[model samples]
Target: MSRAASPDVARNARPYLYGGEEAAIASALSAGQYNHGAVTEEFEQRVAAFLGVPDVVAVASGTAALHVGLLAAGVGPGHEVLVPSFTFCATVQAIVATGARPRFIEVNSGTGCVEPAEVLAALTPHTRAVLPVLYGGRAVDLTPARPTLDTRGVTVVEDAAQAFGSCQGERRVGATGVVTCFSFGPVKNLTCGLGGAIVPRTPLEADTCRRLRSLGIVESAARRAETTTYTVDGFGMRVQMSPLNAAVGLVQLDHFAEAETRRRALWRAYATALDGIDGVALVDADVDRTVPPMCAVRVLDGRRDRVFGELRNRGIGVGVHYPANHTQPAFSPWHRPLPVTERLGREIMTLPFHQHLTPRDAEHAAGELRRALVKADR
Candidate 1:
C-alpha cells in the first residue's frame, strides 16, 4: 500500500512520539537509575506544576492510581463505591481491589459519562465513595451532588485515565478539588509509556499516596539511602512509577500543548464529517472542554455490529469501548438493571483517533463509517 492509501486509518489508537522519547530513555538508561528516582520525582513535580496542584503522586499504572486513591480515601470492605457500568473494566476492578462493592450505575448515552443525579439517586448507607469516570477524555462533573456527598462523608475519586490535559470548566480536571487519577499509558492523551498519577486533595493525602505507592515506607528515597532502617507505618503496595517511564513522561509533558491542539482538531474534523450522516449520532465530548481520546458514535437501528464488521472489512478501525459490566459474569453479584447502559453497550462505536492522524484522516474515516452504516441498512 502507498503512504497516502496505506490503510493508515486502520489504527484506532496509537502513541505519537515527539522525537525526544528515545533520547530520554537513552539518558535514563545511562544514568542507571531504573527504579523510582530523581527522574520520577521531576516528572511528579512537573505534573503538579501543570495541574496547579500542591502535589501529584506517580504510580505504575492507571489501575494502581485508582487502587491507592481509593485506599487513601478510606474505601474498603463492606463499603459501596458508585461507578458507571459503561467504563473500562479496570475501573470496576480497582473498586473490587479495595474490598469495596461496585454499585453499578448508568451513564448519559450522549457522552458515556456518569451524571450527578444518577449518583445521587443510587446512594445507600454503605456508599463510601463515588468513582466517576472521565469517559473519552471528557471531564465528569459531580458538583451538583457535592453537598450531599460531603454531608454523607462520601469521597469522589475520579477515574480520569483518558482525560489528561483536559479541562473541567474554567480549571483543569485535576485542579477541581477532587481525587483525580490520570493514566499516561501508550495511547492516552499523554503517554508516559506505562504510568499514572494521583492528584490528592491535600498535602497530607499526597504524603499518604506517596507512602502507599512505595510499600508504606515512611522514609523518603533520599532518607532511606542515608539510614540503615526504614519504617513501614501501614499496609501498602509496590506500585511506584519507574524512573525510566518518568523520563519518557517528562519529554511528553514538554510537547503536551501541541498534542492538545492536534487531538482537538482531529476530533472536530470527525464531528464535521459525520454531522449529517444517517443512522448514527456522535457521542459529544463537549470538545470545547475535552481533549478527546476517541471519536465515538452510536450506530442506531440495531446496526452497530453490522457497521462494525463492515468498517473492519474496509480496513477502517472501529471498536466498542466497553461491554456493560453489570451483565458480565464477574460482576453479576452486584448486578442491577441499567437499561440505558445496556442499550449504550449495543450502540457505541469508536473510530480511529490518534495524534498521528490528521483532519483528512478523520474525514476519511467518517466517510468509511457512513458507507458501512448504509451497507448495514441494506
Candidate 2:
C-alpha cells in the first residue's frame, strides 16, 4: 500500500530515531531549574533503581560514561583493556581517552558478543581489565570468563551500551559487572537526547566514578547546595549530565517498561516475518531471558552491499552496526588478524526495531528485504 493512501501507514512510516527533544524541552521548561538540578538526580536515581544498582551517575554521553567507568576502575597509560573488535568505535575511543590501550579481540558470529575463549587467549600480564560489549542486546556470558579474569587479577568492565535492559541468565547486565556502562545516545533503547550512565558494582568504584564525572570535584550539585564551599581534590572531566538532558531522561524513564515491551514485540515481529528469507540470518532471541535493544541480522553470501543499497533506495533506513574497531586507522596499532570480526563487520546489519515501529512496518521491511535479495541475485 502507498504510504499516502493511509494516515495510519504514514504515522507508522515515521523514522524510529531515538530520543525526543520536544519532551525534553517541555520538561526542562516546566521544571524551571535548568542546570544540574533535581531532574538530573531523579534521572540517575530512576536509572539506578531500574538497573537494580545502588548508584548511577548520568553523564554527557555513553562514551563519557565509559571513560569515567574505566578511569574509576584504574585503567590508565601502560595498561591494556581487552575489547571486542566487533563493536562501535566509541568503545575503543573511550579506552584511548583514558590513556589506556584497547587490545582487540574477536567476537562470535552467532551472537555477536565477544568470545570469552578468544579473550582468555589474548590476555597478557599487562591486561588490567576486559570490556565486553553486549552486541545487539545479546548478553555476553561473562560467567566462564570470570575465572580467567580472577586468575589474571583483571577487572571486567561491561560495555552494556546496546543492552541496557538486557539480562543474562537471571541477572541484569549492569547489576553484576564490576563497572558497567550504558549509552543513552540518539539510537539507544533508552535515550536522554545524548547521555549515558555508569553503574558501579562497589561503593569505592561508584565514588570514584562520581568524582571523575564532575571534574575531580568531590561535591555534587546536591552536595554543594547543602554546604557553603566546594573543594576540588583531584583531576576530573566535565562529564556531568545537564538538568535539561536529565529531564528528558526522567520522562523516558516513566515509559521505559512500556517502551521495552514494544521493542521486544517489534523484534519478534521482524524475526517471525523475516525468518525464511535467504541471505539473512537473524540472531537468536532468548526471549525468556534477553531483552534485545536492537534487531540485528547477518546478510550472507556477500550480498550486504546490494541489500543495503536496495533498502536505502526503498526508504528503509538500515544500519551497519559497526566496522571492525581494530581495523580503524586510529586503532590499527592494536590490530591483529581477526577473521571473524572482519567477516561479521561486512555482513551485520541492523533493522529498525524500536517502540515506534508497528508490526506491519516490520513486515514491510522484511518484504522489501526479500525483494532486494531477489534483485541482487538477478
Candidate 3:
C-alpha cells in the first residue's frame, strides 16, 4: 500500500448533532440559565424515562457518574469493586475515586464482557460492588451472577457507557436494580460534548446521587433558588452537568432513535462485509436491541498491528478500544495474569464505526483489511 494521502474515513467521527440542538441551545442561552437548572432536570428526567429507571442525575463525566453512583450505592474506602481489566481506564479510575480498590477481573472471550464466573471466584469479605461493563453495547448475562451478588450483599453498578440504547431481552440496560452509568461524550451514541448520567433504581438512591453530584447541600437546586440560606449536610463533589450540556443532551435524546438506526445499519454492513474474512473475526454482540456503538474485530495470526497500520495508510481510521488496564503502569501493582484478556488485548482492533460511515466505506475498509491479512501472511 502506498503511504499516500487519501480521502479520510474517520474511525471515531464527531457525533451527529440533531437539527434541534442549535435551537435548544439558543433557547437555553435566551433563558440565561447556563448552570445546572431546569433544562438539566428535564434532561435527567428524559434519560430516566428513556431507560425506564426511577430517576437519574446528570453529571460532569461518565467517570464522575461512576464515582457518585457508587457512593450512592454504599461503595467507599476499604471496599473492593470487581471490574473487568479489559475495559477503559475510567472504570478503575471511578472505583479509585470512591476510595475503593478495583480488583481486576477477566472478560469472557466471546462477548468481551466481564465473566460472571470470575466475579464469583474473586469475591472477598471487602467486596462491596461488582462493576460490569456492557462491552460494545453487548449484554452481560447478569442473571447467573445476580443470586450470588445478592446473597453477598454486593451492589451491581453497570458501566453502560457504551450501551445507552442497548437492551437484554425486553429490559433496557439501566432498567434493573443496577445503578447504570452512561456517557454522553463526543463518541458515545448520545453526545452532550462531555457529560454523563446515573440511572438509579430507587428514588432514595437518586436523591443520594443528586446530593453527591452537587456539593452535598441539604437544599436542592430548586430549594436553593427559592430560599436565601442553605447548609452543607454531607460530602459532595462539583460534578453537576452544565445546563448547556443538558440542553444538548435533550436535543440528542429527541433524535436518538434515528441516529441509532443509522448506527445499526453501519454495524450490520460491516458484519456482512467482513463475516468470512480470514484473520479477522467480529466480536460477539446482540445487535437486535443494541444501538451498535462500535464494530470491533479481532485480527488473528499476529496481523493485528499490520492490519491497523494498513487501514490507517488507506485513510481508514481505526482504534484499539483499549490496552488492558491491568497492564497499565498505574494498575500494574495489582496485576494478575488474565489469559483471555491478555490474548484479546493484542488481537482486538476497532474499525471505522460511526453513524456517518456509509456502506461503501465499510466495504472498502473490509477490502483493505483483507489485503492487509494477505500481506501479513506473506
CA error at residue 42 for candidate 1, angstroms: 0.4
Instruction: Show where candidate 2 strays beyond 4 Å.
Output: 1-27, 30-32, 225-229
Candidate 1 lDDT over 237-287, as tens digits, reads: 999999999999999999999999999999999999999999899998889
Report lDDT (Cα) of residue 95, candidate 3.
91
Per residue, candidate 3 scores C-alpha lDDT tens digits across 1-378 of: 224323446554557776888888889899887767899999988888898876888999899999998999999999999999999999999998888888999887777898778899999999999999999998676779889899999999999899999987898888866789999998898999889999887878888888898899868878888997998889999999988899989988988889778888888888898978977879977788888788888988778988788778767888998789999999876788888898899999988777666777787788888888887777
Candidate 3 regions with alpha-carbon error over 4 angstroms: 1-8
TM-score top scorer: 1
Q: Which lDDT value does model 2 have at 352? A: 63
- Of 1 and 2, which scores higher on TM-score? 1
By descending TM-score, how would the candidates be arranged?
Answer: 1, 3, 2
- Clash pairs, candidate 1, are none
Q: Across residues 1-378, which tens digit of lDDT does each residue of candidate 2 receive?
A: 245211222222232333565777687878777656777888888888887878888888999988998888889999999999998898999999888888988888888887778888989989998999888787777777788798888988888887878887677878775688998877577777788999887888888887888888888777888999999988798888888888767777777777678878888888888989978999765655666776788999999999988888877777888888888899888889999989999998877666667787788888888999999898
The TM-score that candidate 3 achieves is 0.96
| Deviation from truth (RMSD, Å), model 3 | 2.4
Every model: Cα RMSD to truth:
1.5, 2.9, 2.4
Candidate 2: what lDDT? 0.81
